[model samples]
Target: MRQAHRFGSATIWQRNYYDHIIRNERSLQPMRHYITHNSLTWADGQLHPCNPSKW
Candidate 1:
């Protein structure tokens, strides 16, 4: 908290980071796609700073 206050940010990190569990290939494929394409799809991604769309 001291570092955050020093840097003038309300919080230095999110309350929680996201996680996923892959049990099978069906579930794994999409995760692989997203991880591999995150950079390429940044402009259209849900987490993109400039993107207004929400997942």
Candidate 2:
């Protein structure tokens, strides 16, 4: 964080994060897809300031 501030940059990570446990492959597959495609499927709103249209 200090280095980023010094370089006039910002970090994407927050101070806290959630941790989940995958007991088996079945549960892990969906989460993997969601995480990989979340940004690609973002909706047009305040949360997504770059592109207002869906891909």
Candidate 3:
């Protein structure tokens, strides 16, 4: 049966399949860049739903 989303859904979350530790700023910069870049290029990605969030 289909379930109604009474509380909405997750649009920016992922399963915690793994974990990492950032002991310093240098260790975290790359990850920050990755997320920011992804946001900037999300609309052009083939996996994006609307090529931005969802189609």
Which numbered prediction scores highest in lDDT against the true structure? 1
> What would the per-residue lDDT of candidate 2 be over residues 1-55, giving only the tens digit for each residue?
6766999877657678777899999989999998878867665545565765532
lDDT of 1 by residue, 1-55 (tens): 7867998998667788667899999999999898889878888868676876664
Off by over 4 Å in 1: 1-6, 10-17, 43-55
Sort every candidate by TM-score, greatest first: 3, 1, 2
Report the C-alpha lDDT of model 3 over 1-55, residue by residue, as the tens digit: 1122544654444567567888899999998998899999977877766765443
CA lDDT of each candidate?
0.81, 0.74, 0.72
For model 2, how big is the CA root-mean-square deviation? 5.8
Which portions of model 2 miss their true places by more than 4 Å? 1-19, 43-45, 51-55
Clashing pairs in 2: none
Between prediction 2 and prediction 3, the one with superior TM-score is: 3
* Cα RMSD, each candidate: 6.0, 5.8, 6.0
lDDT accuracy of residue 15 in candidate 3: 68
